[model samples]
Target: MDAKAWDERYAGTELVWSAEPNRFVAAETGDLPPGRALDLAAGEGRNSIWLAKQGWQVTAVDFSAAALAKGKLLADAQGASVEWITADLVTWTPKAEAYDLVLIAYLHLPEDEMQSVLAKAAHSLAPGGTFLLIGHDLANLTEGVGGPQDPSILHTPDKVSAALPGVNVTRAERVRRPVTVEGEPREAIDTLVRAVRA
Candidate 1:
């Protein structure tokens, strides 16, 4: 969705996403010490805020102003600090080797666009810094509870690893995780890939 569409969606709702950090995001990044972090497509800053609470200096980037505003509000309520940027990830150029941790969670896109953005993310990582991605696996479209119906946008561990240059995958797997949304037996087949700059 474009910025305007996202803005409308955010404006129409009190919380577009949950206030808690993504389960994969927390599990994968928990071992790392707090430092400079970048959250791409940081809708409502859930993960960013959590990182901030752990003493990481966080920059949360998203295209929708409304979403950023909501993120700011949540941060304020939590007494956490995060730098918020409003820009399209497709066109945004992050500084090379500028972050200790770079995270992309559930930012599904077409193959070409996904490759471009993930490459930028990998390049933005500092040496020894970790780059983590968690997204709806292609299997989710046919087997999971809820996600974008478009197969072109679903991501896999191989595809995400393929997007990085000079990075070694420490962990890559297709995991079947339970999504405990109330009132339903919901689950998502998602890929978790963690790589580090070489």
Candidate 2:
């Protein structure tokens, strides 16, 4: 979907996504010292606002203006300050080595575009900065639940790892997330990667 489509989706009276940060993101950053953070494709700035509350100076970028507007209200309500930018993630470039952490969550794109953005994310990280990505794994199609149906846009550990050339990959694997489908409890397969720039 394009920016216009996403705008329309986020223009609803209620939020489409939860206000909480993703579990993987919280788990990964909980122990780190607060610093400058960049959240790409930050839909409604849920994670961005969470990061701000955690004492990180956060910049959240997404293509949808409506989503950012909602995020601004959310941040205000939570007493969190976040800089929200309306731009295309695929083409947006961050300031070189400016962020102490870079987060990309559930931003599915074609393989080439995904790689390009991952490279940009790596470039945005400062020395010793962390880059973390969490998204639907390619195996989620049959082995998991609730994700984009298109396999081409789905991610894998190796795919994400290979995109970062100058980083030490601390973790790159498929993780299981418990979810309820109707009434039966199930696990959703997700690809996750955590890397640090040298």
User: Highest TM-score among the candidates is held by which one?
Assistant: 2
Residue 93, candidate 1: how far off, in angstroms? 0.6
Please list the residue runs of candidate 1 whose C-alpha ends up more than 4 Å from where it truly belongs after superposition. Answer: 180-182
Candidate 1, 114-143: lDDT as tens digits: 899999999999999999999889998888
TM-score of 2: 0.98
TM-score of each: 0.96, 0.98
**Could you tell me how far off, in angstroms, the CA of residue 81 lies in candidate 2 after the best superposition?**
0.3
lDDT of 2 by residue, 113-188 (tens): 9999999999999999999999999999999999999999999999999999789999999999999999999999
Predicted candidate 1: what Cα RMSD to the true structure?
A: 1.2
Q: For model 2, give the 10-residue run with minimal summed lDDT.
A: 84-93
lDDT of each candidate versus the true structure: 0.92, 0.95
